[model samples]
Target: MNHEKLITLPCQYPEEAKNSFKKLIFEEAYLLFIVLGTGETVNKILDLATKAAGSNQDPGMVIWITDYTVVSDIIESLNDPLNKLNDLDNTYAFALSIIDKVVDVIKKDENKLDILRIWKSFQLALKG
Candidate 1:
């Protein structure tokens, strides 16, 4: 990512912001799956998700892994309090969105079982 250029650009860069957001979403979900593994409990997953989402005060792993300063600037530029990526609920929603996309991509393929596993994990995590 072009950190300097992205930071210099004004908040009018919705396309850039959207792209950054999408990348962050996928990164977070991928990391979550890798970190959580198949043996993790729902409560454990929820706890990790909450911590990973961060907040206005705390910087989450997502922000840390993806350039904190740039991600923070992107979130500020978004100016959308309701859908801030740092929020826990938004993090869960992002994970679900990724799961949906994966399911769609593998809907008729041999990875259907993988989709079901992912879906069940998310469902348990969401219910927690």
Candidate 2:
């Protein structure tokens, strides 16, 4: 990632942001998967996602991941007001939006189960 750019709120460069997000989606897939799974990892994931999505003030790319757990319990926890989405920070809103979409998909279908498990395994490898 380019360290030269100091991320603001939403990124202003849509194309650049989209491309950057796409790259991160692939490179950080395992990290993302693991982060989304555990309650402990949520904070770090929120931090990273906030940076990734709020760098400028532009929601350029909708970075999608398929490793999200389909359990409503997990979804509920993420949606809770204490999850930081209710904070005063504008960046948190953008990050929450991305997470909300991810959880939505997981809540919708079982067809993604296999892919979700694969992502979990990939996450574990990265952890080790």
Candidate 3:
């Protein structure tokens, strides 16, 4: 994994914002790992992903914070030579792309400022 790139990705944001973003990313990734580890069929995983994303709150957040060891394990699994968990990487990439498109749509909307404000507030809450 590109650790340098991951560490620098949120550098443009404020310190607190960067931390929160990192935490959120980790939480979501861990959640993805759990879902993928279930070894479900592709259709089932897709359905679970949709439900997880749409839920009022992420079930994974119940764990409060993820451990460093867990993060390391996730990275190792993704980097495994056997490509056993490649779907996890692909699903994560696809999810991020979808999020990027959604954000682009929101950016072009007239209520972008309002939406951004709400998102910022949400991020602040997450940080705490």
Q: Give the alpha-carbon lDDT of every model.
A: 0.32, 0.32, 0.29
TM-score of each: 0.22, 0.23, 0.21
**Best-fitting candidate, measured by lDDT?**
1
Better of 1 and 3 by TM-score: 1
Better of 1 and 3 by lDDT: 1
Residues 1-128, model 1: lDDT tens digits = 21211112222455565565556555544322212112224333334444444343422222112222334544344323334244421232222233313111111122333334444534433442
What local lDDT does model 1 show for residue 70?
30
Give the poorly placed runs of model 1, Cα more than 4 Å off: 1-11, 30-128
- Quote the lDDT for 124 in model 2: 33
Better of 1 and 2 by lDDT: 1
Q: Best TM-score goes to which candidate? A: 2
The CA lDDT at 102 in model 3 is 11
What is the per-residue lDDT of model 3 for residues 1-128, given as tens digits with 9 covering 90 to 100? 21111222222344544455445554443222122122224334333334333243442211111222234343342323333333333321112211111111111122333324333322332332
- Off by more than 4 A, model 3: 1-40, 52-54, 61-74, 77-128
The total of clashing pairs for model 3 equals 0
Instruction: Go through the candidates in order and give the clash count of each.
Output: 0, 9, 0
Candidate 2 C-alpha lDDT tens digits along 15-93: 4544444445444332332122323233443344434432333432223222232322333344434343232212111
